[model samples]
Target: MTQQEPAPWDPALAPADADRRLHAPAAARNRDAILSVLRSVLPPAGTVLEIASGSGEHAIHFASALPDLTFRPSDPAPEALASIAGWTTQAGATNVLPPLRLDATDSAWPGTLPPGETPAAILCINMIHIAPWAATEGLLRGAGALLPTGAPLILYGPFRRPGRPLEPGNAAFDASLRERDPAFGLRDLGEVTALAAAAGFGTPEVIEMPANNLTVVFGKQAGR
Candidate 1:
């Protein structure tokens, strides 16, 4: 993708400004809240592999806040990778490493630096629902392979829960996503949990988040 191009899943990447920073208004509003949860859950002093780090806004913000942890932001699109680097440089965030070109549907992610060191956490924010179901399956499979026992795989986004009324806003959002791509829409939480279980992940700890979203954290099962 060219510098001018934007990824289809990255709806928040608006026009860039003078600093080569791509703007995402929603990132500003949600970063702090996300950070609060991350601080409490993320393992201390370890590599964090963030999937679909669009616009790199969250990378800079999270890296700046969690100075002890190294952040590896990644996306499939070239433009998104460039935007990640631009924002990381602009923020002067040393903890934020260079972005990787990672397609979630791929069988596996490229190895991180320093050889065999496993990541302490894998973070995917508002990604799977915007993409295809295959991406979600790939994410679980990759996390199962990469993360150590007890490591966290965190997913944040709107989810359709069993026995819960679908919020009107989420329903509309799901409709819009389906319109964009028939394969993309809010996922059923029960289905996601089952997939995680099959991938050797423990039961998810679900936390309701702002804007009718959820932060679902799954732990890698030991001895699998």
Candidate 2:
């Protein structure tokens, strides 16, 4: 069988340890900022399903800080799953569950969760822009199926906003992403919002973050 190449954005740094914990430099830089928004948006108590949880650093940090809420981190890569498990053990974070092997493009995602553990929120950080558009579509569809009315689906990433020129850094980053994979590049915010709306979500609340990133929150509509 032919081996598939790892994603260009996959974490490449790791500490010298047997537990297989990988490190992403960006995760450490952005976790606290992401957590700040999560504090006010997340449900007080319930599971928060995180998709494409790259290095597991964000999961460990968030789980440690938000002990009231359980975090379920998942990724499609075997290395990523190992890294998440390693970080969970290293941090001794009881709130963070073992990582699941989940692909954002999979239609069977609703069945991938642990029994009776419906998530109160779904979070995807720095994923859509690095993944195929189908992943974004599938993510919305899965979140729509799983979350209860009024639950939030939060996404954090660089996006192209209508009328606003892309920030220089983000513009360069977008180019690099597309150079690596033509299907991957910053998505237009208006398009993502429209897709969410079609999937039974309300208009999103867009919050600006450091490094030209955004935290966009869409709530599941009632009676959908």
Count clashing residue pairs per candidate.
Answer: 0, 0
Stretches of model 1 off by over 4 angstroms after superposition = 1-13, 110-114
What is the alpha-carbon lDDT for the whole of candidate 1?
A: 0.84
lDDT, candidate 1, 6-71, per-residue tens = 123353437766665677776776788889999989999989999989889998999999999999
> What lDDT score is found at residue 201 in candidate 2?
98
Give, for candidate 2, the lowest lDDT window spanning 10 residues: 1-10
| lDDT on C-alpha atoms for all candidate structures | 0.84, 0.88
Candidate 1 — number of clashing residue pairs?
0
TM-score, cand. 1: 0.92
Candidate 1, residue 55: Cα displacement in angstroms equals: 0.7
Give the Å error, residue 144, model 2.
0.5
Residue pairs of candidate 1 with colliding backbone atoms: none
